[model samples]
Target chain A: MRYSLFVGCTIPNRFPGVENSTRVILGPDHLGAELVEINEFTCCPALPTFYSTDRVTWLVTAARNLVLVQDKNADLVTMCNGCFSSLLKATEELENVNKCNFVNAALASVGKQYRGRLVRREGNRSIYEPVRVRHIIEALYTDFGREGIADRVRHPLSGLRIAVHNGCHFLRPTTRTSVDDPAKPVMLDTMVEAAGATSVDFPDKQACCGAGGGIRLQVPKLANAITKDKYECIHAAGTDAIVTGCPYCLYQFDHAQKDLKVHPIPVLHISQLLALAFGVDAEHLGFEWHFVAVRPFLKKVDAVGVV
Target chain B: MTPGGAPEAQKKRSTENGSSDAKSAEGGPLIVEDSVFTGAEHDPDFVKQIIRYGGKDVQTCLQCGNCTGVCPVSLKTPYKTRNLIKLCQYGYKRIFFTIPWICAGCHRCHEHCPADINPAEVFVAIRHIEVREKGVPRFIRDSTALILRHGFGAIPSDDIKRYREKEGMPPLPNTLPGYRKVLSELEALFRKTRFTELIGLETGEGAAGERKARERGGEASK
Candidate 1:
């Protein structure tokens, strides 16, 4: 299956490994999903900054990104939850004729248009459709079922316990994003298990990683405090490391431990874990870029020898 | 319902308090520590304005504590989703300037609110109103300026570029900032949206002028 890969801004810069791992996992020899890159894409414009400042501008900016993906004739697949939230939320808004027309007027200035993908007609009103936006984890869970994921694991990560952090943007605002259960999330755990690791349940399993909503960049003290809370719970669960689909959460879990001077728990993007299970070498996954070292995690997963 | 009914009720309650001290000395908004405003009048249109800005159910909020109980940020910060909504319902416009900025946008409150208030969305609506009234915070302005310049929020540092090269990936992903032509397209879009002006990045002459200033600074430093 072909899809447009949106790495957003953070993954390529803060966590290139997640993007690199995703590429390897979806390689032709592996899951065989073709990723079309739209290099002209910009930041998702992230909700906390753009939406807060000007909702119309945020919607127009996101619609521009969606237009690029639509031109590729492939479904949009985002690696970052922030990117997923921004794009998906804009897509929902653009369905209204007024919003679609308003966004199209702005796109017209840039020599583009947002002809929403799911267009239909009802009575007298023209119903434009929101584009199909999917987070990478959601795509992985749906496109490659658990059995299919299990079949590809060259080195099953048995004996390692991983805490799954399904960061808020991916699951919450349930009415809009129905990717998984918002309250009692099990999809991430199921995906973790598919890679042959035990997905440990922790208190506040669905809490924010404190890196979102400009919390980390703005009020860092509060952000670190929230990160400390998540770490406390993960520590209590006694998991070997944390796994998440969002680079922001992964960034928080990986870096905030060092910032808060708390007990450091290694963090990995879900795709990185899956890449390890698929027998890809650790060196290619960009583990060195991580603030908190993943050596202990590497050894626990038996991927150290390869590194 | 009387058009100014809420304000009339507020005024009557202020007189009923039996002490003129509750009113601000200069007749501005009065914010008693733990009580509803007895002197200041509620901006009767505030709820309608919020509802129009995607806080669709803010009016329907029953002030249940579910949104607060489920808010993870409230656990650490002084931010209470329920209290913020109450403040909005009471039409204390100035409170939006500070209180809503603390929201992490986790949306857990969106799911748990029995009133289906989606307090997180209400916070965004409040933020929108706040931005129009008082401008944005410094970090937000700096971050938006970065996006307008580089086409992304986070500025890529030298270390990140070196790491990307070592990993055999391109130093910069072929994105809006990586390609001049692509960045120009974003510039055109931003121009249409007044993105640069909204963020105050264009001091006098807009983005072109800012680029010239940066170039001058670069030469001076050299």
Candidate 2:
């Protein structure tokens, strides 16, 4: 299926590997996925701004992005969970209740507007394919048949103990979202297994990494405390590596290590881990893009027949 | 979503002789209404989401000074148990930032909230919505700058980084990009919505920078 890849803000400039891996994994599968980023798609500025409750500015920022998606007439795919959640929520709100009209009013000076129509009902651009904050390896298994996926693995990383940190807004948690159980998430864990790595079961794996969602700003102590708890738990699991599907979560776990006495566990995006199995350069995957050194964990990556 | 301070007409009425009179008159019990109260029509569902998200169920509590008396920081700030319930009952927007940031997150209020209000959590959700609207504060421009630019939130300038350094941080890599990256991203979003022309923000920092650049050029030529 054809789709437009809206890389969002954090991915391209900060975590370029996420964009690279998403394109790499999906492109090889012949998904015909296209990421034509509209110039000037800003921060969505969700980091700490979420406290404002000025839904108009936030919703309109999202709406403007949707206008670009609609203009391309392609389902927008994103790699960042925050971007996915905001953009997806805006698309749903605009199309369903039209709550986004006020956002349009706020954006009137920009000469941009959201028409609020999903192409699933039309002949083109199946909106259902818009997996903004998606796990690329999971998408391969779900979208492209997994019949030959294991064959693509250059090495099995079965021995590498891994913890999956699913970011906020990526999963359908509870009744507020649609997909899987938010309270007990297994999607990222299951996807990690397909890449031949053990999804080291850890307590509080589904909990937030303590970034974004205004937690860092609104409640810094709690955010740090919770992140500290996550670090301790992941360490207790004896996991050499931590994996996530969102740039925001990656930033949180990677950064939280700085403030606490947790073991040096390298955080990996699911795509980055999959690339490891596929023999992609750890450096090219933007290894330098990490604050926590990942070489300690990469040494654990299975080479040839060994992990 | 008709946001950003009440309209002049609405503000006139809210502060007018009518609403304040109504607020004190109805001091006994608050009722939800669809037209006015946010949780009016779907009181049960709204209350459930509030509780699920870790907030006080104002529906349960019989207001008492028990929460205020038990609160640790209540004396230092205007925050008290009763004020929280009053705002939740009204769905006041101001709590978006204050409740979370100022509370210091002891959860003592949640322990004391007679109505079972997790004031801390309500503040958190409010802050979440707030962050979605306004950008990060200017003070945190450095921390966010470190995270976005350096790839990790740990830097010597960053609070977390200072902690890590004292704790004997390993030679961590610096993944943060130039500050210009953040500027361009914001400028792009603002440009997308033509937010400047729309909100009349004088086009944000980029324009301010441009103006400075032009002045510098004028000085150079002189």
Candidate 3:
């Protein structure tokens, strides 16, 4: 289970906790997935804003990142929904003959080619391979089945209610990302349950976190309003905390909760929670870096006493 | 007609002379070309552009309002996905340009569209049109300039760096050595593709400030 980890801009620059926790949870002492960092990688360049503005630039930029992954000869796993969608969909689109040719031409000047799916011949035999891109959740779900994850939980998070926010890009535009049923997604919830926590069903579980599509930066009031509905639903569910696979959604939920002056609920990337269940210390997991404090929640978890 | 006292007599005279005057017989405004139908309000190329930009199924929208019903932002903002689709089909470029930005890109509309029109993609197509034909929005210009300059959209601040250090994490990753080469390649691609011009980067104030800041930061990092 080797993957070139695509820790897109948000996770590293905004929430190093996410990057730290993901690395720790997936390190040899825990889930043991081989995660490699490709230092030359740039931003996934974001999709809604950048991609919408210019398809060619979007395709070319995404292709450049894909070429880097191809150079490593490893599948790409991203923790950010935006990066996952951009890289995965770009890979799918670049597999098209015409789109690939056009993008490859653009890559030529940059000294790269998106030979997305290629066959090589050796000794009267041929080998075929296609690039694979997956979100960290999908990679986890596939690599370690539900029971496998459950077995690894050193501390079952009993009585810890969690509201799972399946951010849009993870399950959306289904044609590009078919990891789960877009309309009724349960992958994240299933993973949450596998971690020995209760995954509460909220009304806006599948709604946008008001941060996607550059709306947070563009029309922040609208973004905050949309996030307000999500918080209301999460509050209605009476969950202790929120869990999201996407860092942008984590930032939105974390930041918006403060801006709206609502009852503060801690937001965690799934990896952070998984790291907790795997018996990693809170300090190493980057809990202190969170805007909304996780100490109260951690105190409660400590009271639970590894049951 | 008694010193412009009767609109009927003035209308009659104007009709007799085949003159479409701006003022009525009462010395008020006349309603010329009011509520008149003009066949196919949009240019044919408008539909073609939307399709070309990946909204191939936009014309197939059934107007069922399913997209609008499911849109998260539509509830708070006036950004109804269905209305935007309708406007796009009708070739209402101005409305399409401004209204599509309100979409949060949640894709609920895309997921629920009975027609599978993928209204989100349609909105992206509309945004593409807006950026190319009009100009990129300020937020987009600022953000894009950041990526263009720093090789990352959000540069980790000193405070963030200090926090990462406290956490025992490695300093946040900066642009790898020879990042300038990669940045230039990207810029050239942007230039050759005319994305620079389309987003008004050639003369955009946002781009200029971002470039200056990037230069200072680049030197400082060195």
On residues A157-251, what C-alpha lDDT tens digit does candidate 3 reach at each position?
Answer: 88889999989888873355679877787778888898888998877577788888877876677778889988999999998889999998998
Let me know the TM-score candidate 1 reaches against the reference structure.
0.86
Which window of 10 residues has the lowest lDDT sum in candidate 2 chain A? A172-181
Name the best candidate (by lDDT).
1
Winner by DockQ between candidate 2 and candidate 1: 1
Better of 1 and 2 by lDDT: 1
State the lDDT of candidate 3 residue by residue for B25-56, as single tens digits.
22322222221112212344677888888786
**Model 3 TM-score, all chains together:** 0.87
Q: Estimate TM-scores for all models.
A: 0.86, 0.62, 0.87
Q: Write the per-residue lDDT of candidate 1 for residues B1-222, one digit (tens) a residue.
A: 222333345445656662654444234445533334542434657788888777765668888788888776777755567767876776766545534366888887877778877887787887777766777666666556556666776555565566667766544544334577667777787778887777667664344445654454344224
- Candidate ranking under lDDT, highest first, comes to 1, 3, 2
Q: Give lDDT: candidate 3, residue A225.
A: 82
DockQ score for candidate 1: 0.36
**For residues A1-307, what per-residue lDDT tens digits would candidate 2 score against the true structure?**
4466655546654566676666665564423455454443444445233213334445665666566556564556666776666666555556444465566665565566667434365565445333243334335555644444556776667777788887656663111343444557666776677668788877756655665545554445555665777788888888888898888678777777866655678887887887787766666566666779988877777443462
Instruction: Give each candidate's fraction of reference contacts reproduced.
Output: 0.61, 0.08, 0.64
**lDDT by residue for model 1 (A83-194), tens:** 8888888888887889889889888887889886645567887764556898888888889989889999988998789999989888863346578888687778888999
Model 2: CA > 4 A from native: A29-37, A45-51, A71-73, A96-109, A116-138, A145-148, A172-175, A217-221, A302-307, B1-222
Number of the predicted model whose DockQ against the real structure is largest: 1
Ranking by TM-score: 3, 1, 2
